[model samples]
Target: MARARSEERRAEILRAALEVIAERGYRGASLASVAERVGLTQQGLLHHFPTKEALLIAVLEERDQWDTGGAGLSREAWRLDLLEPLVEYNAMRPGIVQTFSALLGESVSDGHPAKDFFTERYATVRGGMGAALRAEFGNRLPGGLTPEQAAPLLVAVMDGLQYQWLLDPESVDMPGAFRDFLGLLRGAGDGPRG
Candidate 1:
């Protein structure tokens, strides 16, 4: 019973932490703020996460596998199972997107706890997206752009688009952008498609 209760409290704190961090940048976030978000005391927050860094790292780690086993992240193909679920998740949990964007800004310094995590994550995500593209257009792409060369560029485009969409929600359609980006990756048509 005690273990279950502890786990529940930790989950509560993590959910509240996501909101707090997303609303207020990492530098602006504090244990006190998190506690207020979830109606806990600052000391209560500390019981689960001894420090801000601990909480931040835990949140990021949890996000890593919260939906694990649902998506096969690989360097060969994209199971619609994987990308579609992420698309669904993004719609269901806009907070996750906000939290993810917040962390990208926070994960700059090599000494920052979140830096390495984001770095590796971006690498894997970029690689996976690239690999999926290569599978779709291995022989058709002009000059045979390798996955290694194309993956990072695709990820960069997605990241840049994410920023713009966040700033002007009405100005951008994420799914449409993703579809167009995928087309570009496969050396398909140049302009937007319906």
Candidate 2:
């Protein structure tokens, strides 16, 4: 019973943190606001995370974990894995998607927490997406293009598409878009002409 309560409180805190961060960019979120969201006092929240930066770091790590869900994912196959979840993730939490997009800009600065987070995150995801592509179309791509060549663009498109969908979701056909992506990747043997 005690363990259950602890686990429940942890989840509540995590969810509250995500909501606060999603609503307010990483810089704007206040501990007071997050505590209120979870019915805890600021000091109470402090018991869980000692400082705002630490909490923000926790939030970023949690988002990455929640986003990836521990699949021991190969960087090469990350894009394929992201495919089924991206549409749902975008529809359910456009704010989170927006927050992630916004963080990319911030990550350019030296020593930003998200800088390391995204650097590792992208490396992992890129590797997984590349692996997935090679697995599916190893023989279908250009003589030299390889899955690595196409992985980045495909990821960029998906990320960009999320922004577009957030602006006008009705314009996107989520599954069909992914299907077309696969088709293009499969036909990459023809590759893009010079």
lDDT of each: 0.69, 0.70
**TM-score of every candidate:** 0.71, 0.70
Error of 1 at 176 (Å): 1.4
In candidate 2, stretches whose alpha carbon ends up further than 4 angstroms from where it belongs are 1-8, 20-29, 50-57, 63-69, 72-85, 139-144, 167-180, 188-194
Which regions in candidate 1 have their CA more than 4 angstroms from the true location? 1-5, 19-30, 37-39, 67-81, 84-93, 130-143, 190-194
Q: Write the per-residue lDDT of candidate 2 for residues 154-181, one digit (tens) a residue.
A: 7787777776776687887654566566
- Give lDDT: candidate 1, residue 35: 88
- List RMSD in Å for every model shown: 3.9, 5.1
Please report the candidate that would top TM-score against the real structure.
1
Candidate 2: residue 158 Cα off by (Å): 2.1
